[model samples]
Target: MGNKLFAAICYGENGKKILTVKCEPEFGIYLRENYSDITLGYYMNKVHWNSFDLNGNVPEMIIKDMIEQSINWY
Candidate 1:
């Protein structure tokens, strides 16, 4: 899967997830601000990466979009 997004589980923490898509920096900021579940990606560049709570308020569509965006990115 050239889908670079579905890389790996940042850790064994099944509740949170690392970003799979290379989205705009502005969008990443917005996501972290707008969603309580979103945050800077684990051990990654704060400006270019993001992480989210899989069981939080983030809508299913948003997660799907991230996956799709990652597919295109690779």
Candidate 2:
């Protein structure tokens, strides 16, 4: 296997992890289904995590929203 490429980490109140989100799961899934640049989390629970290609076609607003959601969800 190779090294995982994660954009950010989401931690819980006690500093435990909630998920490693590349983008919000729903949007990530849509990107996965509709595009070739997004994928499920490299080493995380696929249902709740996703890995996005930052060099891909995703928008800045969406990326910001995803990061916010990741933090909010925790």
Which candidate number would show the highest TM-score if scored against the true structure?
1
**Residue 50 local lDDT, model 1:** 70
- Model 1 earns a TM-score of 0.68
Clashes of each: 0, 0
Per-residue lDDT for 1-62 in model 2, tens only?
13544445544345444334755567678767965545677567787676565555757776
Q: Which residue window of length 10 is worst by lDDT in model 2? A: 10-19
Q: Which candidate comes out best when scored by lDDT?
A: 1
Query: Could you tell me which residue pairs clash in candidate 1?
Result: none
Per-model TM-score versus the true fold: 0.68, 0.57
For all candidates in order, the CA lDDT equals 0.63, 0.60
Where does candidate 2 stray beyond 4 Å?
1-27
Question: Each prediction's Cα RMSD?
Answer: 3.1, 10.9
Model 1 lDDT per residue over 1-74, tens place? 55255323465275454443455678777877888877777766667667766556888887776666545554
